[model samples]
Target: MVRTADEASVFPDVVVASIQMAPKVGSKAANLKRSIELIEEAAGHGAVIAVLPELANTGYVFSSRREAFELAEAVPDGESASAWIDVARRCKIHVVAGIAERVEDRLYNAAIVAGPKGYIGTYRKLHLWGDEHLFFESGDLGLPVFHTEIGRLGAVICYDGWFPEVYRLLAMRGADIVCMPTNWVPMPGQAGEHMAMANTLAMANAHSNGLNIICADRIGTERGQPFIGQSLIVGAQGWPIAGPASKDREEILYASINLKETRRARHLNAFNDVLRDRRDDIYDPMLGTGWPLPRH
Candidate 1:
C-alpha cells in the first residue's frame, strides 16, 4: 500500500500499477470479470500502465495437461486477450498480463503486452517451474523489448526471473522497465512470512541492469498448491518503492516512476556504470567454453 509520491501534485513520467489477485481454477468467466474490474480501477487511479499476475485468466496449478489445454486460448486474438486489449484501449493505458497460450496442440506459459493503441507483443515464459514442464513448452521468443511513448518495455513470467540473463538481454536491447507476471510459491523449508526470494531476485536484477521492474503475484491456494503474494515494484536503484504487499490479499500497488532515470542510475557515483563496467570482454569468450557465464 505504498504510494511513491503525491500522485496528485507531481506528475511523474508514468504511474504504474501492479495488480495482485487470486484466480480460481477452471473459472475463466469469473476471472476475466474480476480482472477487468481491477484494471478499470487502476485506470481510474491515473495509472498509465498496469501489470497483472501470471495466468490471470485461467489461474494456476492445473491438475493435468488436458485441463490446461481446455483453459488455454490463442494469444492476442483469444477471448481473454481481446478483453484485456479492449479494456486497455478504453482506459487509455498499457497492460501487461499473463495468459495460458495455445498454438494448435502446443501450449506456452505466456504474457501479453498491450497499449492504448492496441496489442503490442507477447513474452513466453523462458523457464518453466515444476509440474509446468508437463503442460507448457519452453519460450521461443527469446527476450523482446517494445518501444512506446512511455519507454522501452520488456517482460518475463514467473520462474524466468531466476535467470539474470533474461534481464541482461532485455537491458542490452534498451529496455527501461521490465514487467513481471508471477504466481510465486513459498520456498522449500522456508517458514514465517519473510520476503520471498523472488522479490530479492527482482531487486538484484533491477540494480544490475539499471532497469525498473514491476512484479505482480497472485495469492490463495488452487487445488492444493499455494501461491505467495508479495508483489512489488523496484526502482533502478534496486529498492522497493511500492510494496511487498500482503501475503494473501487482492490489491493493487502504484508507483510513480520516471523511466528516464534508469540511464542516470546506471552511472553509480562518478566512475562506475553497472552495464559499462561489466567485464564482457573477459566473459564473452569463456561463455562458449561452458565456463558458467550466461549465454542468453
Candidate 2:
C-alpha cells in the first residue's frame, strides 16, 4: 500500500479560501471595498491563496452595453484590480478575482491573479455563458499557468468549468491549482432544489485530472436572475475540504491543498496513471487525424 507522508515537510500546505459574495449592481466602489475586507479576513486566517467571485467588482447582470463598458476597467491598472493588488500586497497573500476587462472598445469577462509582489497574470473567460456573449468578447489570451512562489496556479471563469478540455489542458500544463471565479446560476430545475451542478462539475474535474479546484461563487439575485451560492474548495482527490457554503448567505470557505500529495496521488496505483495513460495520439484536433476509427 502506498502511504501518505508528512504534508508540511514535502511542501508548505497551501491554505486556500473562497469568498462567496453579493455585489450590488452598478456599485463599483462599494463592491471593491467589500472585496478588500473579505480578502483581509481570509489572509488573517492564514489563507495564503484567496479567490473571489465572477465580475466581483461589478454585479453580474448588466442592463446595457454602456453599463458593462462603464463598469469594465483596465487590469492591473484598473481601479478594482489595483485595489485588490494593494490588499494582496498588504496581507501578503495571493488573490484571484473575476473582473470585467476592457481593451479599446472591446470588453472581456476576465479574472486577474495578484500576489504579495504585485499582479501575476490574467485569464479571460474562454467560454462565454448565456447573456455574457451579448456584452463581452470571448477570451483570446487562452489558458495560462502562472508559476508563483506558492505553486503553479491557473484561473478559469464561471462557464469555462463546464468544458472538460479546459481542466485537462491546465493539468497537462502542470497546474497544481485552479482558481475558479464563478457567478453560478441554477440549471433548468436546480433553483432552490437539489445540489448545485457547479459543485459536482468541480469535484469531477478535480478527481479526473488530479487537480485541486477552488471555486468562489456569488450570492443574491441580480436583475431578476438569482445566483446559486455554494462556493467550495476541492482537493486533488476530489473531496470537498471546505464547503458548499449556504445558498443565500455571504461567507468564506477554506481548504488546504498539498502539492506533493497531488503529485504523488496522481500515481493512483502501480498500474494506472491519470495523465500518463492518455491516448493523446488520437483525439487532439490539432493533429489533423480526423475522428479515430474503431479499435478492431
| CA deviation > 4 Å runs, candidate 1 | 1-12, 285-296
| Candidate 2 lDDT, 1-296, residue by residue in tens | 33346556657777999999999889999999999999999999999999999999999899989999999999989899999999999999999999999999999999999999999999999999988989999999988989998999989998899999898888877889999999998787776557788888999999988889999999998989988899999989888988989999999998887787877666789999787777767777542234232121
| Cα lDDT of model 1 by residue, 1-296, tens digit | 23356742342468999999999999999999999999999999999889999999999989899999999999889999999999999999999999999999999999999999999999999999999999999999988889988888999998999998888777777788999999999897656866789999999999988889999999999888999899999999999989999998999999988854666778798999777677766876322223332212
lDDT of 2 at 92: 97
At residue 282, candidate 2 shows an lDDT of 72
lDDT of 1: 0.89
Show the colliding residue pairs in model 1: none
On TM-score, the candidate that comes out on top is: 2
Number of colliding residue pairs in model 2 = 0
